[model samples]
Target: MPAFPRHVSRKNEYRILSAMLLLLHLAVWWDFGSSKSRSLLLAHAGVFLIWQPFWRLEKRFGLKDTVLFSLVSIGLACWIFFCWFVVLIGLMSGFPGYRRSGRLVYMPILFFLVSDLLIGCVPHIFHVKALPPAVTTMFQYGLLAVPAWVFIVRPHPGGGASLYSVDLLRAISASMMTGMLAVASIAITYHLGVDYPVALFQSLLGLALFLFIISWLLSPRMGFIGLAQLWERSLMNIGTPFEQWLAELAKLADQQQSPEQFFEVSFN
Candidate 1:
């Protein structure tokens, strides 16, 4: 067997992180009766699971495939949520009238959830090469905000529509700000609780604050530039050969033209 490279080891580290996140999510769901908490945890698991495949796809097939998969995954998630909403409505409406409707609603969400989990496992399933630093970091950090926002802020009371806006820059800023607030609030809560470990709370606070600052500084710019570059690179990868061939053909055309004539004449 061939020796495993250092990069493969690093990729495995991400895989381990993803697995731990999944386990934590399931544990929380099992222990908590809070529907909001469970939904938040599920969203976190969904986004975290996506990062592995997003990175691996980008490295292997390039940015276009990565973006395509991300979009499709998100679309499926939206469909799943919609289906869940319909089921909840049907169940609340009651009885045989809504029985078939409820079943229909339940099936799609279950499918999407399973598909999302499998997609998340893609990094471990396929042994692709490591991506460039910018590509890796941008995808990882950009996606990190998804679960953070969904879990900590969006489903919470007074989370605001601004947090879920489609504007990329605004969304990135809101994610960072809300994440910081969540951390600050958690730290204060721990401090006020006599039984809680102050040292651990402080350490978590410091880490969260550090990440908040970094995201605030980096995310919007990276989101714009990185996505633009990714798209540009994808297009270039597809276009460069054709462009060269056109250039060569132009050269051939020019060479075949006589200096005295502006246009080439052919005898048939």
Candidate 2:
């Protein structure tokens, strides 16, 4: 028997790898029982199959350094996913509080992940230029409406008492809307006419960035109300420091005034 050439052996190895990947994908879909598990698997697939290639595009043309840049990209992606996963676990596990609070914390993450999955699949149906405006509008409106409906119609476990105030609700909605718009804008700019896989990943990244910013701005106001409530805690904390200082000075002057003196105080 003749020995196979090196090139032929490498080709065979690649074919086997491709076949294995296909089989694994089939198995995942075939035994899909839980939506949560399916979602996690889909997210993993989207990252590896869709996003990784987009990051490797520059390498495809030899226009940029591939190894070092790819490594950095992978590292950053890993860090972000790891941190998000940790936060997600904490939210689900009831870190600071049990029951209702934990559910409230987890709700946004669940909403975002579902939104991302929906947006990720959008590129398969729509063009990038056509995407941004529609996406922005949907997010702006959806962000505003969804939570309001959820709060009013499907209030948390405890009751409607823990529901958000109108101003806070509006702010949260605005922030989410702004974020979705940003993501759509970035996707339209970066992946103008790319293939479906590359475009999908770009759009996903844009959505993720938009969501991150919105959440960062709105989270403190919604759940951690301490920052917003700081000034309103007491009447003294409500006024400017300079105003309080002036009031103190006026009090001192009034005390120093002599009861026997008939001094005329000029009014400005």
Candidate 3:
């Protein structure tokens, strides 16, 4: 198949992913039997038919998948959603499709999965109050806002999916850091003797300091190599490591029969 531009290829995937996310968010938020929740559930199932990665993109579903999809859809349409549905969601997410997508593409999905577990499921097991309105608003609206900005406002390169690529290390550390901060603040409030709000304030202050440290590390200006430079070295052509250059040269060597041809191909 001919290669299409990144934006062209990924645009539909983005829409499909966004639809699934929006439905899941609404299903988790709305009350049972509300908004003809049965219809909402059915629509959610239909979107997943396209979003699922079980089969080839253009291939028709086999008998087994057809039966399973129909049965699951009927069952879900009968008002079987919320925490239990989220468990099903968490399981379905393990289908190895989105997990293999780009880090930027999957991070939002991961966050929502965590949200369903934390906000939707945990309360059923433990006594928990509704999230602060500000927090809830941020999660709800922030999801919509980011996608809109990406799709409508931000200009994506034909060669790249986003303005910049996210490294796996930074993504992993950011997720871990968020969880640690939340846990530490709560622990401080409960065990270390302080008000919850007070603990939160302290965490915010620490976060600001952390941001300053990160800023400095990005462009330290201290003769030492900055972290950002090291991170970006893998991307830009000029400063890629010698091992990568050697590997590319080897590939070019194999492809071209003559030294003159090899030099010509390498220069291109």
Separate clash counts for every candidate: 0, 0, 0
Model 3 superposed RMSD (Cα): 11.8
Name model 2 segments beyond 4 Å from true: 1-117, 120-158, 161-163, 166-191, 203-268
Candidate 1 structure quality by residue, lDDT tens digits, 118-150? 222112222222234475445434444333332
Which one is best on TM-score?
3
Report per-prediction Cα RMSD to one decimal: 20.8, 24.7, 11.8
Q: Report every candidate's CA lDDT.
A: 0.39, 0.40, 0.55
- The model with the greatest lDDT is 3
Measured by TM-score, how close is model 3 to the native structure? 0.42
Alpha carbon lDDT at 265, candidate 3: 93
Residue pairs whose backbone atoms clash in candidate 3: none
TM-score of each: 0.19, 0.24, 0.42
| Per-residue C-alpha lDDT of model 3 across residues 1-268, encoded as one tens digit per residue | 2223333333565565557656765665555355565566667766655655433345566688778867876666322554344444443333233223344455555666556534443333333344566875676566565344323332233322332333445445545555555565566666767755567568768977998887777775855475677767755644667868898999999999999999999999
Off by over 4 Å in 3: 1-11, 32-35, 62-64, 77-101, 124-128, 146-268
